[model samples]
Target: MARRRKGRAISGVLLLNKPTGISSNKALQKVRAMLFASKGGHTGNLDPMATGLLPLCFGEATKFSSYLLDADKAYIACARLGQVSDTGDADGEIIHERSVPELSIEQLQQVMQGFVGAIEQVPPMYSALKQNGQPLYKLAREGKTVERKARPVTIYSIELINWQAPDLTFSVRCSKGTYVRTLAEDIGEQLGCGAHLISLHRTHTGGFEAAEMISMDQLQQVRDDEGSIDHYLLPADILVSHFAKKNLSAAETARILHGQDIANTENLTGMVRLYDPEQQFLGLAEASETGRLMPRRLIVTDETVTD
Candidate 1:
């Protein structure tokens, strides 16, 4: 017999304002225990020193979590110029320090302009990227350095928010898999001074914004007041809101639930959000070039079937 999981089968996405000094997985676990949810997962990870928007998925909502993983992200980062760290962030050991060169805002802006576009970034060793079934950070802890290939990452924008001699603050909007720490070091290199990331806070990811995020204290207060946490949860479909929506009749919905394709006369040739006639979210479907809507992921529940 299969063993059943404990806790309620809750579903939705929680935009958590993760505090600094805690890993993303730890934050997700705390929220899961508070909600007593049967399943939970984070769309992406934030380092222990990084804070801000972390979208958490529970139960059925987890099915769409991967969409956010590949989504673009925005962050405000503070980098300390003239200093270098082994881990590329403030938490790492200080490796070197140099004299800060005199630079103007115009000069800084000119330097930043070079980063706005597609570029290659070498993954840092002190990262969660795995190597031969083991995390690279683990190897780093053992004083081992491995060769990491440079990967392509796009920076949509990079703006200097503040500059205070050795400390520089900037905001960046970049594609997934970008390493902001590397960016700081690269900028420092351009100015002939070493640098390392001193702080980082993610402001946005996919369709979720930092404005919608709630803190751990706020969540606990709601729990103490016996208020439903669902009040803060956004609909799971919001993860794929960028995709076009398709409404189907009861017959079509039934056919889609059974893993069958329906004719897509509109000839939409990409992923789409599916809903029933009553507007209840079904799941996701892929529209083919041949004018067919093929079921990809479907939400299964007792209430899913309807006349």
Candidate 2:
């Protein structure tokens, strides 16, 4: 028999303003400890050098984190010109340096525009990417270099936010798997000078926005003021807000809860956020073309949650 996790079975999502100098997992652990939640997970990782919106899911919300992980992301990235780092960011050793050229915003925009579409981006060596079951970062730390195939990544836009001296800042909306650090290095190379990421701040990921993010201090204040932080958490269904919503009658909900398929009358198909007639969130279901609604994932209790 497996041991059950001991803590509050609290289920919801927290938009954390992840501070720099800590790993995403570390930030998750801190918030989980504050909430006393037994389970917690993050949608995507923000490098220690980067800080911004990091969505932390707890309890049943962890089940839908993959949807947020696959969602698009936006970041405010600042790169320093005339230098290249081994890790492609300020965290690594500088291996190359050169004088920066006097460049106009127009020239910078034109060069950045070249990357604002379907393009190839090579993942950085100090990244969490794995090869031969070992993380590439581990090999990088061991003074090893390996050939990495360029993968297709879409940069929806790279809007130049500022260009002050040797520092250049831009906001990028990109598809999943786009590495902003690599993009900065490529831009520097295009300008005939080397470059490296100095700072990166994520502003958006999936449906969550910067406006929804709460810093660690803010969270502590909330707990200090209110008796509990539970009111601040968004419902778990918000993680899968992309899914179509369907309401089930009491009888249908009962049948589905008992692990039985029910007939679909609304002709809905694909994954859906299933709710009880009273608007309580039940979990998820898949409606097939054959007009059958099958259980995909369900909460363990009748007193789970409402939409």
Candidate 3:
């Protein structure tokens, strides 16, 4: 006998304040079960030892995850100046430890300047990046080290918040794929000492900030009180605000909904925000060299559907 399933309609994002020591996937699953959502995914990952805002996309919003993934991120990290770890953060075994140098605030500030602007970084071994169809962390667990190519990433801003005995707390605004652990290690090496990240917290990614985030407990409370959870969602187009806007006529909107490439967009080159005749957000599109707007990610045809 086939089991009949009840239709579950859940869509939109839940901004979760992920606590330290919980994996991003675990948090996503917990939120999924709480919402009873059929489809759910996270836009970006926060490491197990890292805490703070993790955007979980559910239902139709999951389709536009790439936009969120590519957005820039902000973090606050504490670096232990006298230690190095296999996993780069505090969770792993200490591979090496040394005495921290007497670092003055000014000297630390000077060192931080070198990291601003564009910089090259080698990905940490304790990461999800795959090589030869296997995760690099798996190889690292076996005490094997592999050559990793340095990737170019921009550090939009880095500020030293405080300096204490053997720890330094700082905030960073960086492009996607920037590793705070690697940055800490590199800073330590430059200062003639080795270091590792002791703590990490993502404060923002794209337009999503920790201040505006809701937790799993809060979502559960909302569900219990209202008999529905409806207040946790942000507009899907929030991550694509950096792109240019292109409003389409009703005819164009109909054509686009039918998967027809739009022609005659004016002076657009990169990812563009699309709006329909009713001023409703459609999705993202790219302007072709021939002046056609090609759809990249379309979430829903009706903007009011988010509610």
Question: RMSD of each candidate?
Answer: 2.0, 2.5, 3.5
TM-score of every prediction relative to native = 0.96, 0.96, 0.89
If the candidates were sorted by their lDDT against the true structure, best first, what order would they fall in?
A: 1, 2, 3
Each candidate: what lDDT? Answer: 0.92, 0.91, 0.85
User: lDDT at 255 for candidate 3?
Assistant: 74
Ranking according to TM-score, highest score first: 1, 2, 3
Error in Å for residue 250 of model 1: 0.9
Runs with alpha carbons beyond 4 Å of true place in candidate 2: 224-226, 303-307
lDDT for each residue of candidate 3 in 191-280, tens digit (9 for 90 to 100): 878899999989999887888988777777887787666567766666667789888998888777766689854878888888998887
Q: Model 1, residue 301: displacement in angstroms? A: 1.7
lDDT of 1 by residue, 1-307 (tens): 9799899988999999999999999999999999999899999899999999999998888999999999999999999999999999999999998999999999999998899999999999999999999999999999999999999999999999999989999999999999999999999999899899999999999977898999999999999998878778777898889999998998898888777899996777689899999898989999887789998887876645433
Give me the candidate number with maximum lDDT: 1
What is candidate 2's lDDT per residue for 169-287, written digit by digit as tens? Answer: 99999999999999999999999998999999999999889998889998888778866878779999999889988888999888878877888888887888888888888888898
Candidate 3 TM-score, C-alpha based: 0.89
Return the clash pairs for model 2, or none. Answer: none
